[model samples]
Target: MKRSAAAFFVSVAVLAAGNGVRADGPDEHAGRAQEYILANDFDEARKELARGKPDDVGIATERARLALYEADCDGALVTLSSPDVAKTEQGAMLADIARGCARVTAANVLEEDHDQGVWIRYQDENDRALTPLIIETVVKAREALTRDLGATWPKPTRIVVVRDLLSLSAMTGLPYESAQTTGTVAVAKWGRVTLLSPRASIHGYSWRDTVAHELTHLAVTRATVDRAPLWLQEGVAKREEVRWREPGPFDDRPSPDAIAARGIELKLDLPLDKLGPSIAMLPSADAALVAFSEVASFVRFFASSTPPGSLERLFAALRDGKEPDSALEIASSGNLKQWDTKWRAYLQSKPKEPLPPLLSLGKEPAPNPKAPSLREVRERMRLAELLLARKHPTEALSELERLQLVGAAGAPQDDPSYRYLRGRVLMALADPGRTKEAEVLFQDPKEVLSSYGPWWALRGVLARSRNDEAIAEPSFAEAVATDPFDVEAACETLDADSPTPPSKDPSPLCQSARAWKVPSGTED
Candidate 1:
């Protein structure tokens, strides 16, 4: 989700009325600054402010507004709280918003790290594990966005990973219920990317993609100078989210087109025009998903139909104060309505039977009260793991079989932990048919990719068993990528002939994984 404010021009009008002064009366420089700020031309705004008296309240407020647009919340607060600006009506309103920014960012950030042009902040040292991945994603995403949208990062971009929903709400000013209802784990606001940690989600999320999505919002803000409407902002972001990585396809299984097609069939699709404000504020999780899918599909359609660099021109038009409909006219075939009709016809041509799963906060499904308690389930899983570790394959297999029987009522059939353990047991037994069955269990690479280390490591093992180096290599790489602290996954990615692979360009995680040693109890 990307947070947008009501028009700044409206605020400027309110400030003028409250002070009983004409907006352009006796402060022409301040008035010009306000116009530049609305156009998202901060450099021009700064130049205009320089022409005014430094202590002027209107100049000070516009300066603070520019800082806010750039995600410099602390700077904005300082300007707003200065003696000359603090007492004025305009300053007071800007100050209040700055205070919220302080609460969301500076007040909550407990730790920080930097790499290249990116900085990451979090409350826990444990989240250090995510720093490398965040940096990697941002570095790649920055390049992709620059190439595609001509967006630039004027300063080091910041990524703040908060631990829970309360922190997320405080940071983004999204109501707690709205975020919970729509399963919004992240938002591009305060000129930074603020997100919940992957640990906040029970099954974990495609956080790398989420990071790319939010980063795209920041890019759109920059390219359009805060002029992008919610639909265009979100639509472009969704279209670019997966473009930052290899094998990244916009039309993967249950793709945007597929989801949008299904949403249209169900008549649940929100019109792009009616996706009021933000998808995070949609009525339900289903609405949010449908809306996202719809916009993503439309953006893809719009981008494909237009000539190369049409998106860049679109952003330029928006930044220059063109209305969205007119911007579309500049970017594509003249009539927005006709293009939308063509997009709909294109969407209807997509496969819609397998609708993507409804979007959620990636929370675990609540256990059925009549079924076994979660603790009991964990204990049983642990017992099976211990038996396997002790070389008691028969007992491990038996225990796992019993676990399946008891947990079938409530446990997710695709739970990665269970599959990993069962796959391990099957490997231990050394039965050819069972090994094949284990391969079947681990074959769903998308599921493995979204899961934790165990599933990824297990998939790597299965791939190696079949002498499939192509699958084994990426699987092991993903295992380390998923959980840097997982010794098995880390060590698995190391080459047999040498401690490290021969690649000249090794990732930070890969370097760590190559050097990491397996714990004593773990098998080679």
Candidate 2:
């Protein structure tokens, strides 16, 4: 979790004293206002501030806090720049943070949507297609977390989707380098959730799941009144990220226990209590994934073995200022250390999955001795895509064949992009033999899931051709969910010969996709 801005209430109080502005004297209005702000009762906090002298230190700081809490960086800056508040050391620090946030959010706010207590912010017109998915995830998450964790929200959740890691850093105050290191795409901090746009990734990420995961952090903070420790916070968030959705292929593919078991076998797991401030600050993506899996598995174990309301009781204890270990003991009816031991033993019994490759994001390709070979591979892939786009499927096929040979030196055999492009080229050729080859390429559901969009769309098309409705529907849905910006995926229908299905409302993704310009012969 990103740290909250430094507490400026004390400094503001001192500054107020120097100005002979009495705030806590007879009515104690400022004191009560600060208490309300700390409890996240911004409305009540504002009321209390109204009751106090406008220029009172307590009133100004709490008002500023309320503005920051709502992600009103401009409003915060105005409050902090007040003559009395500006002189305080903490106020100056907070002003700097607000300025950074203002710079980052200014562009994203150009486009915005909100409903069902969720606000979505993004910059590009193309990303408008993603608003529905984000809103659906958050709405479901709110209901699920409230039912499971007894979490409540006093304000509408704000979500900002940025185009890059740099904006994510500026908005959240996490260093840009830290985000690149751990492949951190989203963070729930300050007062809102901020995430990287799926379009920014080389291959699209599980952006819907990511939004739910980050929102869970906000729910945890709300439930614990911001007192939950790092381990408890992360563990609970990971455990609940998938709770909003029905059981499906997309649900924690490797499973947390399996990943955690692998991490243990590889000696890559971090101690739950020792995971520093945020997993995003970990040295590498491998370390971050291991840490996430361990905490997620441990929390699942902890939640299951304990009584029905054990997690709620734990949240209550944390809110009441109990230490995390003591809170665990009270909720679980066992010592914290004993609970950890049992969880570890349980994890050992689960089937282990091999550790997946470490992910890299928002960074240039690392220096390689065989740079020319890598460049050739990239060039061939680019030329193949251009060739396929320009109705030169035969040429595209030749380029892909060369790419396959190049892979012999040292490239992944199952590179999803390679398989997806080759399949598309083969389909465009419309030869029975090549079409059969395309079908074979997309037969692996795991491989299809790993690709950005085209593979899933191709899978859907092939399945539809064979009248396999089961695979076609889900594959097309997954394709749209994976990369809605892709015109073909978004516009693809499960049954091309059938009339458009009637609906109370059409899908935003489809609407956006249909309106987008399609390259010639994209679906052939």
Candidate 3:
């Protein structure tokens, strides 16, 4: 997805060589390199070139081009350095061209936007007028941060939205390399939010929610500067999104459902002294989700019970370099322990609703009796799900391919789930060559099946591929937490050496565990 011409160039060179005529001159070799790059054969292009030579100006230029294509601007600079390059007629021109390319690539990779002071880019490949909407949302978010946290809020933040996932990922180096990645990602440096196009299509719901979520991260980062704890930052962000969504004035009080869902007894009162420390890091997916959910719930309670302007006061204290506990006490007019007790009492008194039993597919036989005899197409889907559950992703893919053909007649458009499933299967296959295809498919918003356990698990796999352990860990946890029985087998596969699985029971308020079901007729 990170557009590299090196591979393309290499392929063209190989194909040209296969025609039984080797390139004789600098121009011919350079032409071949251009062709290979166009064809996406970077390896072949690199193979055809001579390295570190001043005599071959064409080869040197091609190498510089290849370096730029591969995102190695530094390499490009070094490749362009030659005495012959300075003296030759075309050499100086080629060197200038290479330098310009390197500069643009470097700016794209590292520099923030001059106007907004954020690295955010608005993409409109489909030529949609979504840029205005992004600007509006950012303005609103900024206002909310200023009103709530005043001097503690960071300035010059940027927000980006891409029309397609692949371009977004390629540009941001984010997990999944696309907007179609399951959700939004916040790049801390510029406080940039990258929203995939499909997710953006949800309009009022998806885009606004994502903006609120990412902005909360930005606000918390500013509130604590570099001193914030990871759990606290994530927790506060999660809580703020839900809070901002409530109707009328911004009341700190959480919805009754949120209060009831988070149990009073399980409240985590992590000491400010130990809060930023890494002792709470959980390798197990289940533990991590629980921790995130618990911290989110805790923040919600704290905000709801505290006096008006208390949150603002706390931010002000932090900005003045006060210790966290002292700042909290000054803000609330009491120690955190007292606030904790009050929050616990408030939660206990709230009305409660019993949660549905965790989906127990292991003990109970499959309940969807209609699943077997529905149709050949539906049956294939069922088979694919079963195969995925059994960890036979290859077999599942074969079945899905057949299903895709069968469904092509009547259900051509309703194949997001199929594509999503196939993407997962490919990830499970784990061949490095297939990572690109897998990433592309995963970026399709339609491929994200909210109700499917394996879908989230596959997202986890893709996240891991991109080295995003923070996002991946929670995604894996969501899979197991969504349906403990179905994902129990897969959870075992994640940590075979550990023997005992961490608690798979859903937390009182598992954020992602709450279904992301879109209406049946909705299309992005």
Give the top-scoring candidate (TM-score).
2
TM-score of 1: 0.73
Report the C-alpha lDDT of model 1 over 1-524, residue by residue, as the tens digit: 00111110000000001111222224678877765554456788889989998767777777887787666778988887787677776676667667766765654444344437777777544566567678888889988888888777655777778878777776666777877767777888656777777556533455677788888887777677567777788888888877888763122545668767767876888778777767878776666777777888888888888888998988888878798899878877565678778999987765555532212222334456655655666667677778887878778888767654333433345556677778888877878888887788788755521345667876886677567889887777666544554544645532222343344345544444444434323531
Clashes within 3 Å, all models in order: 0, 0, 19
Query: Lowest summed-lDDT stretch of 10 residues in model 3?
Result: 8-17
Candidate 2 TM-score, C-alpha based: 0.79
Error in Å for residue 144 of model 1: 1.2
Estimated TM-score per prediction?
0.73, 0.79, 0.41
Report how far residue 498 has shifted in candidate 1, in Å.
Answer: 20
Instruction: Using TM-score, rank the candidates from best to worst.
Output: 2, 1, 3
Ranking by lDDT: 2, 1, 3
Per-residue C-alpha lDDT of model 2 across residues 1-524, encoded as one tens digit per residue:
00111110000000000101123333477766654554467788788879888766656766776787778899999999886777765466567668878887776644344347777777555677787777778888888988998777765778888888788777776777877766777888765778778777533566676777787887777666667777777888777777888764546555678767777776888777788777777786667777777887888888888779999999888777788888888887776678888988888776665532322222233444533365577677778888887889999889867755422322344555677778888988979998998889878766422434667877887897888879888877777666665555665643222333442244666666556545534522
lDDT of 3 by residue, 229-333 (tens): 454555565555534433322122223234234422333334323433221232222222334444566666777777777776776676465766788888887
Score residue 195 of candidate 2 by CA lDDT.
76
Each prediction's RMSD to truth: 8.4, 8.2, 22.0
Off by over 4 Å in 2: 1-39, 48-58, 87-89, 107-115, 356-383, 398-415, 447-451, 465-469, 493-524
